[model samples]
Structure formats: structure tokens, C-alpha cells
Target chain A: MIQAISASDYLQPVHDGAALPPLEAALKNLCRERFRRIDRFIQLALLGSARCVAGRTLQPDCGIYLGSGLGPIGNNILTQQQLIRDAEIPKPVNFVNTLGSSAGFHVARNLGLRGQNFFISRRGASLQAVLGAAMADLTHGVVGQALVGVVEEVTLPLGEHRLRQHLPEDRTLAEGSHWFVLQPGTGDSRSLDLKRFAEFATLEDFLKSVWRTGDRLCCARSMETHAAKTMQRGFDAGALSGPTSAFHDSLEAAWLAAFAVSREPGTLFLVDGHPERGWSLFYLGA
Target chain B: MAGAYIRGVGLSCALGEDAESGVSAMQRRQVRPVVLRLDEFDEPLQMPYYRIPDRAELFDAGRLERLLPPVARAAVAQAGLTPEEIHRLPLFIGSSCFSIGLSESRYAAALAHQSETAIPMPLCGYQDIAAILQRALACRGDTYTYNTACTASANALLGALRMIELGWYRHALVVGAEWANRTTLAGFSGLQIVADALRPFDAARKGIVLGEGIGAVVLSAETDSANRLRVIGGASNCDTWSVTTANTNGKSVAAVLNQALEQTHLRPRQVRGIKAHGTATPAGDTAEALGIRQVFAGLPPLSVLKPYLGHTLGACGINELILFAGALQRSFLPATPGFETPDPALGVQPIITPEAAPDGHYLLNHFGFGGNNTVLVLEKTAP
Candidate 1:
């Protein structure tokens, strides 16, 4: 019942003043008045979702499921800094954007989606969790269609913290948005299906029980060392982007889900594990 | 499949520590206003906040860790679930600022010391509330955290109910915790939504008085005479008209309310009463009043609980659920506190007098920031 009809993503690498792509024209075309108050994160989310829908007339009950690691952190930190430094009053616009799910609201508002839209914070596996929830809803027929997405904005505060830990210097902290349109598929062979998804309390349990017969294993570099070692030995390891993220992992899974139809029947094993959130394994393909 | 029933509930607020005590104190209308004089604010702002009175050691890093676990334990114990059952229990928690009070302090301390003390990981990113609670309660089932501002815990409950209906889990624990923080205080103060006193659904209503505490519920597929109340159904949606405020036209909220009734197969007349999300903000109350009037032909005896418990924000979903469910179980409808005169323009009136609980159903509405609106319908079964 969890049919993944199509998927798409919008990614960007870190650079000097590499701002979010200009979505104003496209957003304005969708809804001019509501686009005025959207923040960078929301703009990113709308763009990703817009690309996925591709002008397809959607049902009013389309659910918007968005996930973020540091949701609107850039703006949140900036607002907090202004409050601390200048003793300035908190702006209602800035405060609203800081709610983590602001983008979900903006997207729903712009798209005229009246279904359930939620924004959950799951550090490294936010989008996966969001996708999992969407699949549950779709399989149960709670929603006609669900637009699942993840947006993260790498902020200076987060970068400074990462630097302090001396983890990966050129870790390539980036901002990106990835969205997938999940709904019941017609008799289209091009459609990619979500085979299974499981959440484990520990990496050990996840590795021991994750699906094996797959064309490749896709995951973030920093997901888990032991599991990565085992995956490398067992399957064709398809390393996600070096600048690892839940958004990136989801994009990779979507790619694999879409690409699976071009070749012989096979599976794509995706494992995403976080220090605090344990492990999530997703099997996407035929 | 057995319906998901509220086996036990635990809440800590201005009312009391546990649900039974909190419900009792809420019925008695016991309130203590919390005054705020933070470094960010020039004047000492006075607002009605329902903080746990017994724990007056000021906000600190460990406030949530200290306040939440006991409530979780109490709910689990009240449900008569053994430690083994708890260990295998799935948990879903909602929070607007999960451990932000602690994270902010850590960031401040690092600044003071001028030391790169590896910016406490939780501060750099989101705190996994499920992981924190799992460690606290020693439970290991699937966990999720919903963060849709005020409707956070309501979504948590909705998610748990879906999983239970799917036969994925037999029992689930839903928790909501939100403590007052400088950012929220300043943000509301700047928006001019903070009222000097908590006055929900009143003619001269001010804005919300932010409160803090934790609320938890143990939902199980099994039901005994002790806890037979069933979670009938619910619906949640985004207004998308506004981010900070709901649509004054009331179309979006009314749609969601109508959806809840449709899904539950109950008419407005069948609904015994409604727990309005009367935050007392001008736009909020106006929209809610209009929404309720549009959905219910004859407005059920409305009760606003925020005046008694204060607005717990994200925690309001679970906190208010526990409080209202407890009253319904006792067949007692607590009168809407702090409602003296109805605003004529609002066009809806609440039951100012206490009444008996209707044997059919009750609806609870929790509308939140970013136009996130959630409504839950709880059905009362015969004993």
C-alpha cells in the first residue's frame, strides 16, 4: 500500500554566499501574497515540492510531511542574537519562521493542501522518519497523496560546534531540500516501491536484521562505523554525498528507488543511524 | 481490533503533580501567577503560569529531566503496566522547546568561560525527546517526537492512535513537555500576546500566559472497567492562511472540526461538550468561536481549561487531554474558569456553570502557531 510513485531533490554545496536558489518567481506564480513572508528554508521546501509535483493538479487532501535537522536555525539564531546584542524586540515574522515546521505551513498554504502537515526534528534521519510516517499514512489510506521533504540550513553556530569537535574539517556542511511524492501507484512499471522500513534501538540490532538482497547499500559516511564496515563487505556500498545529511540520504534512496526500474530487478538498502535516534533501515526497489 | 483506550494519564502543572491531583486542583480553581523579569525584558512582566509549585528551584539545565520522568513513571504505574511491559513500550513525545532551557544555559556557560566546550550536542541540534525518555524510563520500542508548535502532543497522540489501529503496537506512551524560555517570553512579549492575567474566553480577554510542565498518557488496546474511555477519532490540518495566527474567517478550523466528526461518525448533537482552544488572543478566540459555531449547530457546553492550567503550549495537547478526560471519567463537567461575560462579537458562549458529563462524546480542539490546528474526539463508553 505504500506506493512511491516518484521522487526528486534539490541539493547545493557550501560556497561563499551560496544563498538558496531564487524561488521568488516560481513561488510568486503559485501565490503572490503568501510568498512574501516565506523564509529561506520555506522557499527551499516549496521549490523542492514544486519540482516534484511538476504542475500536477493535486488533491486538496494532499499531506505535506516535512522534516528538518536544524529547522530555520539560521533565522532562529539570528533572531536570538539580535535579541541578545541589540536588546531588540523579537520580530513576529522571524519568530514564526523559527517554529521548525514553518516551511510545511507555507507549502501547504501555497499549494492549497488541506491535509495533515507536520514538521518533525530528527537530526541525521529526519527525512527518512518523515518518509516513514508518510508511508504509514498512505498505506492506511489516511491521505490520498503525501509530499515528503527534508530541509536543513547549515548555520555558523552549527559549523562552529562541528569545528570544535575536530571531526571533519572540510566536512562540506551544506544546505539542501529533497522531496518525494508518495501515493498509490497505477499500473506503471516506472513506479518505485518502498519495500520495507524498520527502526531499531541500536546499530547492532539494525545491522543484524537489515535486508540483504539489494543492488547497493546507500548511507551517510558518518552513520555508523561498524555497520558501514559490514555493509561494505556485504553489498555494493553506494556512499551518499560526503557532506552527509538525512536529506542527502533520502535523496540517494529516492534515486535508487527511481533507478531500480531501468535495470534488472533488485533492491536498494538504505541505513541511516544517529547517535541519539538509533537506526532506521529502508529498502527501496523492486 | 480493540480500540485504543486511555488506561492512565499523568500531568504536572500549576494544578498538581499527577492527573488525579491536577484534575482535582483544576476543578477547585487553584492558580499561582508566575512573574518574569528576565535580562532580555526591561520590565517585570506578570502573567499567569502554571509551574509545578513544589519544585521552585528556578529553571535550570535539568528542569525537564527532573520534571518529566516522574510523570511518565506515574502514568505507567497508573496503567498497571509492569516494568517488562514498559520496557517494550513505544513512546511518542511532543515539545516546542525540548530541553531548550537546558541547552540555552549550556550555550551561555560556554560563552562565559570563553571555552570551546564542544557546544553541548543537544544545543547544536535537536534533542531527541524519545531517546531522553527511553533512557529515563528504560523503554525501547519505536519512538517519535512531533514538534508542530502547540499541536505537538496532539499529533503525537494521533500518530500513536494510528499505529495502534494498525495493530503495530498494543500500548503507546504519549508525552508533551514545554517550559518557559527567554526566546518564547520575548517573542510573545514582542507580539504583545502575553496577558497580565490568563483570561480565556472572556469579554475583556487578554492574550495567553505561557506556562510550563509535562503531561503524559498511557494508551493501550486493552480496556478494563477502570479505564474504558476510548479514543474515537481525530483530525489535524494546517490553515496555511497565516503562520502566526489562524484564519479569522474560520473556514479552515471549521473544516478540520467537521472532518473529526465525520471520521468519528458523530454529529454535533452527539458531542456532549467541547474543550475550546481559547488562548484569549483576539484572533485566536475569534476564529475558534466562529469555527465552533459553524461546526456545531447548537454549541455544546464549552469549557476552556487554559485559565486554570495556563497555556502549556506544546504540552497543552497532552496536558489538556489528561485534565479533560479525567473530568469526563468522573461524570463531572468542570465549569469554564475565568469566563465572566461572553464577547458578543465572538458569537459563542461557554457553559459558565458546572454540568454532568454527557454519556456520548467530547471534542477537544488545540489550535497552534503556523496555523496548525488539531481536534480529538474522545468517546465515553457505558460502565
Candidate 2:
């Protein structure tokens, strides 16, 4: 078992059919004051998150696991023209962004990670996949400290599709990027005991085992199935209420979980609730 | 590190439409990589690619309906696996562009206002490969589709290995299917990347060629009597210098190979004929040459499979591995069909004539445009 030394989250919302908000608007919302292109918004959120978590950790070998939704936003547009014009596939310049694990590469390279990086993209199971891969990489000595985040960049495809599909209003293209640093159990001076990293075959199991007695559950898209299951059990709003978009949404959970610290920290819990292929993940606060 | 086993395989390309048919021809050194005949976007290029037997065979119900929408049905069927079998294993589908081919055609059709005549689901639509699997196999277990340009399937295989290693699942179903589409042809045509049909590692190669079809295999931890090939090891790495182009120096490519070697706990000499992802493009051939040299240095003779299988983006990993193992077992490496002269830029040499099979394991490497490289080590197992 490992301990998350520190954690921080950043969220950027992409509305449907609207051009991107100003790079300034994207930057100003962040706890950090860094500026870059709107396209690099996910990377920026990750940078701030990694800094927040790593600042308290002492581990030297750190890696990153990124969960995301809609994958890389720009890649869609990059290949859009190719699709529109009926052109032969140009050299696939936009292919790089499609990599779910490589999202960490941006943060790692920016931070000179020069160590280990993995991008786990499991559509609805993004969070579960990332946390599992990150924790596994750490335990297996794949790296020392792991910086993880889930980011979602909404584009016309996500929102317009919801509209086209007539899904739900609040469910429209949600976005967030969450990151945390996990150190070896003894690496950091902080003490928080994690119960067990658990998985589920369905959302019902998650709610019964973890959220049966809880309220105000903070969830990302990865928590959808379980989120739905909990909602059915009178947990709260369904998938429409919580995080929208990529593994990036894990950031929103980190933010809410951090805020719960002053309340005796009964149990900082994370669970998928309802995953597409019957995959859900849970993490505990020691 | 963990191992996954390969069971039930599928292949389709310029060479043949099914595994049995294609492997039969490949075993005897009979393959014809053809330069497609189409418009400039379909503009006929002079590149050689594994012959696509006949597009009609792809539709011939006598043997075709056996395949499904986009190409999923065909692939799964060729594997001789039923929905029951697929539902039991995790599904990983790898492809560069799932169905850009049909999608492009439909886009043009819709553009021309030929709505009624348009293909209902332009390959990219729900009915393509992804939907087909979810529909046909009713596969609900950890289904993922990987799109990493050329190395799509290879990278997908990497995920299967990781999942298996983590003990998350005992069995995985990997699918790599490449079929002709207008976009694939256009992409290569636009960049002029297609060589006169891949003469990989050959001196006179101008570029690589494109092929299509499906490659499906079941990987399991328990290699019972059904196990055909054991996945000794697999690795994926990003060069990170250029998103669309390989870093050229091949540092990342070599690093992945070293990592795979370390995991499989096999030395360089343990591998025999290497299955080179020789797309046979100018930069591609060179990068691969340098990568091989970096990893093997004075290693075993390299055999090229693109000549028979062509390039099956998502399917290349499983597709090539299928043929490579069969060819090695048969002791016949297909000739460098169109190779007339060698390029100076290329680093290592490719086997010119079919050499007798040596006793040892083999290495297979595939590199995609987006800096993704995957290498698999396969050891011949006794029956």
C-alpha cells in the first residue's frame, strides 16, 4: 500500500458548439497562474496538480497516470479536415494527442519526469484504470512517486451528441482534471491509512459496501455506473450531476475530497458505482 | 512482467482473405503485393502490396457473410470463436482509423445528396468494427479500442499484457483488423509514403504499401491444449520527439526492446528470425534499421512480412505475428519481392533468400507514426 502525500485538482469547462474560451479565462480559473494555449489546458491543470501533490512528498522516482474523456480535444479537429475532405490520411499529426497515457508526458516532460509515464484510457472506466495502473506501477517499483490526474475536454462531439441523443441538461460535457502524488507507505511523514483498493462487478456492489451510509458523494465520470447505482439507492443525482468528460474529472473529486479533511475525515472514499464493462475502483483515506 | 497466450487467430490482406488461405500461400513463398487500381485519391500508385485476393471474397456469403459489419464479424468468425468465447475474455480492438474508409465514402455520398445510395454506417458510424464486436460477441468485459496510427493493434496488445500481468483478467481477446478505405489510401497518397510495395530491409525499396483485413486472437494465462502461441513478452514506447514522425534516432524504440528483453528474461541471441515491421517507407525503413541495430546490434537475420500481409494498422501486430510464427515454423521467409537495390540510409540487412529455420525464439517490432513502438518476443512451444 502507498500513501498520497498531497493532492490538488483543476477544472476547465468546455461548452458545446462555442469556440474555446479565452486562454486567459482558462488560466484565471486555475489555482496556479500559468498561461498557455487553450489547447494545452489539460496539461496546465495537470502541472498545477502535480506541483500541489509533489510539494509534500519526498519520493525521488515518480510517475504519472492520466485518465481522460473525449481523449485529446485537438486530435479530433486535427483529423476532422481529413474526414471532411475525403483526403488520404495525412501523416496522422494529431495521433499523438490520442494517447491517454502520454497526457502525463506533458507534465513529466514539463517537470522533467524523465522517469515513468503511462496514459490509461478506459472510456467510462478512466479513473479506475488510471488509479489501478498508477498504484500497480508504484508497488511493482515501476517508479517512485506517481502523479495522477483525470482530465476531460468537451468538444462539439460530446455536447452535440448529448443534444442529438437528447440525454440530459446538466450531463452536457462536464470537464475536470484531478492529480495526486502517491509515495511509498513510509516515504512521507504524513500518516493516513488506506483500507483497501477495491473493485466491483457493478455499481450496486460499490454502494452497498462503501456509500450505503454516506451522502453528498463526489464522483467523476469513471464513477458513472456506481454513481447511477447510488442514485438508484437514493445517493443523489445520477451521471448528470457529477463530473463530466475525461479521466481529467478525477480532479474534481480530489478537490471535494480535500475539502472534507476538517470533518474528522471519516472515510475519503472513491468508487465507480457503475462502470461500462463491470469495472469500478475504490480508494480510501487512511 | 507477465505472459499472455495467443489462441484462435485471423488475417486478411492483399495476400488472402482468411488465416487458413493466407498462411497456406505464405508457407510456400507465393504472395503478390499489388499496387491498387483506383482514382488519384484513388490515383493508382505503383507500390506493391499483398494482394487483396478479391474484394468480392470479402462479400461472398459462401465464405464472406461469415465476416461481420465493418470487419468485426469477419475477424471474429475467422478466429472460429463464438459469442460465448468472446464474452468470456476481455476485448481489445486496435486500428489506426477504425472505419475512415467507409466513413469517407459515405461523407462523399451524403455530400453528393445521394443519401439513399449512401452506405448506412460509413465505417466510422456505430455499425463499424467497434459496434460489431459489442453486437456480435456481446462482449462486456473490459472492452477497449486503441488507435495508435500504425501500431494501434500492437499497443492494444500491450494493454492486454498489462491487464494480464496485473491479474485483473485471465483471458483477453485481441483484435487487429485492417481493411481498405479511401482515407487510408488518401493518407499515404497525400504524403506519398507508399513505396512500390514494401521491400522492407531491401536495398531498392521506395516505400511501404497498405493492406487490409482482420486479426483476432485470444490470450489467456492458462495455456491449456487450446494455446497456439504464448506471448512471452510485449512492450510499447513513445519516442516523444515528433507526434506524427518517428524521432528517427530510434532511442525510444530500442528502449522498449531492451525492456521487453529484460521482462522475458531472454538474451539477444535467444531470438532467431526477427519479424521487422518493415513498412518499407524511406524514413520508416531507416528508423527500423537503426532501431534493430540499437537493440540487436550483431543479432539474428531479419525477415520482412509486409510483403505478404501489407500494413494492417490495428491488425498489424496480431496479423504479422500470425504469419511470422507460421513462416518460422515452416522454415520459409518470403522473398523481398520488389527489392532491386538497397538504400544506403538503411542500417541493418534483411534476409534476402529464405533461410533454414534456426532453433530459438523470435522478436517482432512495430512502430506507428505517433512515436509509438511495440516489440513482442515469441518462443516456439512444443506441441
Candidate 3:
């Protein structure tokens, strides 16, 4: 078991064809020059991770597990265009940013750490898979600490084709970055345990076993149908209405869950689901 | 860490369709250049690559659907596993191009305002490699796909090892598949790294020949088994000095090598051989050479597979790893066929002639863009 030490999120509402979220001052605070030419997916990931380790002492041995719905899609499109249309050579930054793992290196360089860095792309389940892997690594003593995170950028091809395929129109195309520190321990009385289920037979079976009677439910918009029905069935639910209630992606759902858990000190079940990818249920708080 | 044995390995590359034949060709120093005709270019662009023969027809069925399943099935069969067992075993896959070859053509069709309905659903995402493999192999367990440039599949192996060590799963299948695509070809062409011939670790080495192949390995936690090679330990780290290139000093690369050795509880002298990730690129060769020297006082007999297999990119991790294990079992190290004169700057010489396989552990390295570096220690245990 591992404790969630800290959590940070950098989310932006992206309209259908909006450009990638502008790099905020938080990202500029750490490594402004380094963030210049990189794509927006990378910028969001680093910005969120920077906030995650903000006031805390940096752990050089900490690993980074980044999950992206579409790895470097923006840069991939740009590089493809340059090669086909302009017949121009790819710039150094364009080539580098086009790689899938570039964001992990960017975060690690800014944080000045050297440890295992893994970048996985699982489309809808990217965040869930990364978090599960992070918890397993921490439980196995793979590292002293880990920055487990996810970043998704609303590029035209990605937002229209990939994200919109699964998400309903009400949800809108979303992009954000979320990061948390995973450390070994039960932490405190209010710390919620993190467990990875290889295969879950049903959400009800999972809830009946671990969830307390008063545990609140938080979920991504993708899970609205099932989650709504489950909540209506009256199974330990709360916080359906709040300021941070509108969440489109897994990162936003996780960020809101973390924030709610920290403030209220109660159960916050963050559920993210995709038919093709399966379900990721995060039990937060005590 | 818990012990993970390489119970089975499967491969389909330029050398051969199976591990044994690929190893045989390597030992025999067979050389060939497979070519892919890019229809996108106007003036007949036939890019040279290490492509599997007669797989283009399979691409018509589906790109990843063609390459991934056969290799995965072969690996599972060699492991003496059934479809029922595979349904329970989680999958960890890595690839730089997961059917991107098919996607490129579809994207072009879309760009030309053609009907996008012709594109298959499987070609849409990189995760399709795992998805297709899972359905084909009856593996419904958890799946993870790593895409860290060239080091992708190596990192996937590391993940499988760590998870098995944590007792998360008793067995996991690690698979890697990269196919030749116009986008990747254009990308590398723009970088100007494609060499006329691959001459890894050679003084006159030019650059790299892009290749495409698929490789798979079945890893089980059961020790005291009859597997020939076992994954003892490994490490992966990134150098932030550059994204497209390695840190010139090779400090991070050296650290990862030391880390793998330390974790495996082995000394430099204990390792009998090394499989260098010699891409034949000038900067890549230099960094790897320096890193190897820093780890071992007198480097063990080293070999470069890229000369024989070409640079398979993401798939090279599993492809080269399986071939290495096969070569050791055959009691012969494949010669670096193109190596004539060693670069004095590297201060190391690759095994230009095939040599008798030494019994012990071997160090395997795979470095990629964004400075992702991985080193694995594999022990050749007596059956």
C-alpha cells in the first residue's frame, strides 16, 4: 500500500478547435527557457509535476510514470506536415518533441532527478494504467518516491477523432495534466489506500468489498451513465454537486477527487471508465 | 527482486521468421537489404529497410494485425502455454509504430478529402497492438503499452519484470512490434541519419538503416524451471541533456549500467559478454562505448546486432534480446559482419568474428530519443 503525498492539476477548458492551453506562470517559474519550443502536452505535464513537488524537497531517486491519451500528437502532425507540404527539414525541437517520452525527460530535468522514467499511452485508460503501475512500483520498493501523472492535449486530430469518439458532446473535448507523489505507508487516519485490480468482475463487487457506507463518488464524464445509475441505487454517494464538479478527463476527475478528499477528509471514489479500456476506480480519503 | 525467466521467445524480422533461424543467419553473417516502395513520393522513393519478406499482403488485412499475432503466438507456443492461460496473463507491449504504416496511408486518404470510412478501427491508435494481441491470444488481463522512442520495448520488459517481482502476476507476455511507415521514413530522412549500409561499431560507420520487425517473450516468475535465460535485473533512466540525442558525456548511460549491475549483484568481471545498442550513429556509438568502458575495466566480448538486423527502433529491444538469448544457447556469438576497423576514439573493439559463447551473465543496452536509457542483465542458467 502507498499514500498519496501530494497532488496538483493544471486543467484548461478547450473548445472544439481551441489551441493548446497557454503555458501558465507556474510552468514558467521552474524552467521557462526549456519549455519554449516543446509541444503543449509536454508543457501541461511539466507544469503540473512542478506544482506537485513545489514546496517539498526534491527526491532525486523518484521515478516518473507519465500517461498520455495521445502521445505527442500535436508535434507528430506538425512534423508530418513539414515533411509533406513544405518539404522542409524538421527543427531540432520539433524532432525532439515528436518523441513520446519527451515529456518525462522534461519533467525529470527540471526536477533534477535520475530514476526510472516510463511513458505509456493507453488512450482512454492512460491515467489509470500509469497510476496502477506507480502504486505497484512504490509497493515493491522500486523507488523511494514517484511522480505519477497523466497529460492530454486537445489537438485537432486527437480531440475530434480520439477523445470525441468516446466522450459525449456534453463533456466537450478536454485537456489537462495531473500529478501525485506515491510513497510507501498508510500515511494517516485520513489517507485512502491505493490498490490495483488486474480485472474487476463488476464495479458493484469492488464497491461492496472496500468502500465504506458513507463514501462519496466522483467520476469522469465518460462514466456518467453507469455512475449516475449506481448512485441513484443509493450506494454510499455524495458530492454530486460542487464548484469542481464539471470534469471531462481522468486528470480532472483525479484532481477534483484529491482536492475533495483533502478538504472533507472522507471517502472520494474517483471512477474513470471506457468500454474498450475497462474501468479505473481510485478510492481516496478515509 | 523476484526471478523472471524467459520461458519463450518469438521473432519475425529481416533475418528470419523464428528465433532459431534469425540466430542462425546472424551466426552465418547473412546480409540483405529489404526495401519499401513509398507510393507517396512522386519520383519513385524506394527506402531501404530490414523488412520481413512478403508481409505487405498481410498489411492489406491490417498492419499490426499482420506482424504482431504470429510472433506473439510463436512465443506463447514455445512457452508451452495455452490460450486459456494467456487469457489470464497480463500483457506489456512496446512499439514506436503500432500499425502507423496503415495509418499513414489512411491519413493521406483523409487529407485528399477521400472517404475516411475505409480506414480500419485498429489502425487508429498505438494501443491497438495490445488490443489486437489480446484478442488474438485470448489475453483479457491488464494491458500496458510503452512508447519511449527506441527504448520502448526494453522499458516494457522492465515493467513486466517489476510487476512479476511484486507478485502482481505470475506470468506476463512482453511484445514489441514496429513496421516500416512513410512518416517514420520521412522523419529519419529529414534527420539525415539513414546510412547506405549499417556498420555498427566500425570506424567508417555511416549511420543507421531503418528496419521493421516484431518480437515477443513470455516471462514467468517460476524459478527452478528449465528456461535457458533469466532476467536477473535491469535499470532505466533518462538524460535530459538532449531529446533527440544522448548526453555527450554518457554520465547517465554509465549510471544506468552500474545500476543494473548493482541490482543484479554482479561485478564487471562476472559478466561474460555484452550486447551493445550500436545504432551506427556517430554520437550514439560514442556514448555507448564510453558507458560500457566505465562499467567494465576490460570490456567483455561485445557484439552489435544492428549490423545484422538493422535498427528496428522500438522493436529492437525484444528482437535483439531474443536473438541474443538464442545465440548464447547455440554456443556462438554472431560476428559484427561489417566491422573492419574499430574507432580508436571509442577505445573498444566489437567482436568482428563469431566467437564461442561464454557462460555467465550478459549486459544488454537500449538507448533512445529523449535520453531514455535501459540496461538489462540476463543470466544464462543451465537447463
Tell me the alpha-carbon RMSD of every candidate.
3.9, 5.8, 3.6
RMSD of 3: 3.6
The residue ranges of model 3 lying beyond 4 angstroms of the native Cα positions read A16-21, A24-26, A32-34, A83-92, A156-171, A186-192, A196-210, A218-234, A240-261, A270-281, B35-47, B55-61, B113-125, B223-225
A81-171: candidate 3 lDDT, tens digit per residue: 6644444555657766766788898888888877888898666667767877777777767677888888766665433444324655556
Q: Which docking category, incorrect, acceptable, medium or high, applies to candidate 2?
A: incorrect
Identify the leading candidate in terms of lDDT: 3
Question: Candidate 2 — which residues are off by over 4 angstroms?
Answer: A3-8, A14-19, A24-69, A73-78, A82-120, A132-149, A156-172, A180-279, A284-286, B37-85, B102-106, B114-128, B225-228, B331-336, B340-347
The models' CA-based lDDT, in order, is 0.73, 0.58, 0.75
Give a tens-digit lDDT track for model 2, residues A1-286: 6776666555556565666444444334432335233245345545455545544533433655565534564444445444444443544434334344345444543454434444545554555555666665556554567776666654455544344224576563445556666667765333322222224433445455665333344444444554445545655422322333422333445444343232333344444433334434354443
True contacts kept of each: 0.49, 0.15, 0.50
Candidate 2 per-residue lDDT over residues B341-367, each given as its tens digit: 766676677776777765567788887
* Candidate 1 residue runs with Cα over 4 Å from true position: A15-34, A161-166, A189-214, A219-266, A271-281, B42-44, B115-122
Positional deviation of B57 in candidate 1, in angstroms? 3.6
At residue A250, give the lDDT of candidate 3: 55
All candidates: TM-score = 0.89, 0.78, 0.90
Candidate order by lDDT, decreasing, is 3, 1, 2
- Superposed Cα deviation of residue B46, candidate 1 (Å): 4.0
